[model samples]
Target: MYHIPNKYYYRLHQIRPRFKNDVENVLIYMATCLSNLSEMPSDKFAKAMNNAIKLFPGNANKKDKTINNWRTEISALFGLIETDSINQTSKPSNLAFKLSENQDLVEFFKYFLFYFQYPGGYLKPHEILDYINQGILFKPVSYLINVLQEGEKITEGRFYIDKAETTHCIFNDLRVTRQNNPRKPKNTAYLVIHNRKNNINYNWTGDVIRYAGDILDYMVIADLLVCHGNKFYLNNKNQEVIVSFIENEVIFLDYIPLYKKLNLNINDVKSLNDAWFYFVNSKLDQEIFKTDLYKYLGVDSTTYQDLVLDSINEFESKLEQGVEIKTKEIGDFGEGLVLGHEKMRIKRGKREDLLHLIQKIPTQFAVGYDIQSVEFDERKRYIEVKTTISNKKINFFSFHLTPNEWNTAESLKDRYYVYRLAISKINRELHLIQDPVGLYKSNKITMSPKDGADITFTEESSQKEKLLLWID
Candidate 1:
């Protein structure tokens, strides 16, 4: 019931000069003490005046005069007139007022002051009415108060319902759009989840669903099954089990069998509702969901499935050919992709000429860098590309860097950038870490020599030799 005076009161004090000090005190007193009361008695007002006098000793002897002055100032400034006779025996008459008469002041109080004091940035209709009544007692026959109360009730109800709906299934369409890049064209992908009844749609870069243990496991399994070309499934009775998709659409699947196929314990899952709740609240899971199988693939389920299979086949074929060939092919592919991205970005600044200057250093010699590009300001960018086909369940990525590469990055300083490419069967995500040596120095990335080498780069050339460093 503690009502904080909002900016409206301060602005009113600035504009209204007459009885400004007295009116301000009266208003503060009303907000602090009488915020929940319909009316305050004359004796109570006298006590408030006495308390004020005690706080400011200069007015201790003139309390009666100050109280009379406050009464007149309140009536003159705020139109809050005393209705009851000044007799101790009779009960005080209700001081009728209406905050709704000043729409701006009401909004200022509700949105600015009341919102800060209320829990969850929301106020119930009854609390709103109480706050309004604190400033002005609405008349018995007022239609405005009723309308405001009813409107607030409807709005609050709708807000809660919408919040509840978002905890279920949500469909997200992420369109990867790049300008001036011809190698990787723009494409759209659909992220569909089989949770509860709710179906929400979003167009953004981050995850739409929250992730928890059970929910993350479930979603990972779903993506794996979808990629493995297992869309339709039957229950123990051999009937098609329908699961919720987007907006009244259903997919055929029995999640129990899917769980069994993934070797996940069915007992860990409480219910689909519980999974949905966790999925709608996890930040890490949301990121995983966004990039898992949706960012670099097709919009439809069939196309997505086909892309997954094709990627798998291509990977298997390359591995069968030779390990060295597979590594070279993947390295070349990643460097080309990154080079194209760099060209697109540079072209935005009208520095397309830099594209020709950018060289693929990995194939040329034993240089630690991969591609070399120029910034808009004509500064050099030493880029090292590391590509991986592992899923995001592995929180950290480990890659090897030659001693020459570490020395180059250390010497280049800010010019060096590590572009980590996390490639899954259906999508690929790139994360850039600038100044790898600086990152290691700042403890952002851990670095250590591989094979337990004790060689130090700062030592003489005789003791220091090229050795690989394992970075995570």
Candidate 2:
């Protein structure tokens, strides 16, 4: 697929020593300009051209026609206008849909060389030879590899290099081959980037992402050629594949988030429950504990994925106790756990399952809905779900309560009610307490970490502890 233009190759070989840096500058400038095309402002593009012109130290002495033509071409490429009239002499004007030739890689590079060495100077033959060292070929090639690697859907994909003798079999234009020997090729090492991204479940821009395993299989063919000291011709079909590899590499280097921290953006999420974990744990960033988890979780603001992960971890730890509840009639006060081992195994679906439960809540008690689920209005009119550690004293901690349940006391007004469940080995007991805020209104009720005071409970005289009666 690679058509090495004789003219381009020849021109590159002819540059003299003095022109080398200038040519390189022009190439760099061209790259900068091309990179800007994706999101460049009209004003900035003009400035970019002006900056390129300033780079020529001896611009004042350059020939009139040559300089004029150079400026016209470059300016046109960036959508700028040239004025021959004396009236608007100094100011540059804007134009639409700049010249198309400037978009070509060869044109850009050629102009770059001219821009850098204008007054004189060019790359010497020996220097040009030195510049295209082995590593240089890999630089651009690596970009292509990176693009393909990034397109891989699996997080744990890998890459490998192989040198082997191989013969490529052509089948429907896709290069196919199998090798008889295990030995790799010489001088050519295949870099295999593998991932499950190309699996049936993943939808990808097909040519862009090659499973690392597939790449290795193709290498088997290439290995044969290298072993036999034969050069293999790459078909045109591989061109896009090559470009995608480079694109993915560049993208990964410049944009993707690092795995060490979850850059949780609360604005991206709709659920209050999802946001609550972030809001609460975001406070931990201020806590000067030895762990210093704020920085660890990548919380530039209060938003973080660590909060979600932490809540899930804590919830899972509690599952070992075999949550249970005693019947309210037996004076054993406890609410039933929504999910127990009897119904389903404790899996890594805490957040998702909880979200589902929230949605399943009767729409009559709902306040809002989004693409994924619904939420109860904060008006104390809705039931709040909470978890109790045991049925012993009916007093316990509620680690990850739904947002609606937590807010009824404040946002729901007096209608907020707490539905408490006592988890145990056998089953759970359910208890409902209405308007728990009344307890705090009279008694100097203080919320502590040991026992969260944020919850709303029933008045002392009310015997309405069985929550099932109110709903079922």
Q: Pick the candidate with the highest lDDT.
A: 1
Candidate 1 lDDT, 347-401, residue by residue in tens: 7668777667766663436677898988888888989876543322211233446
Question: Which segments of candidate 2 are over 4 A away from where they belong?
Answer: 1-380, 389-407, 444-446, 449-472
- Give the range of the ten consecutive residues with the poorest summed lDDT in model 2: 165-174
lDDT digits (tens) for residues 65-138 of candidate 2: 55444544443322233333223232232111111211122222212211221001122223322322211111
Residue 351 miss distance in model 2 (angstroms): 32
Clashing pairs in 1: 210-279, 210-282
Give the C-alpha miss distance for residue 186 in model 2, angstroms.
59
TM-score, candidate 2, is 0.19
lDDT computed for candidate 1:
0.35
lDDT of 2 at 30: 36
Q: What lDDT score belongs to each candidate, Candidate 1 first?
A: 0.35, 0.28
Task: Tell me the alpha-carbon RMSD of every candidate.
Answer: 27.9, 25.8
Which segments of model 1 are wrong by more than 4 Å?
1-224, 227-328, 391-394, 425-427, 451-472
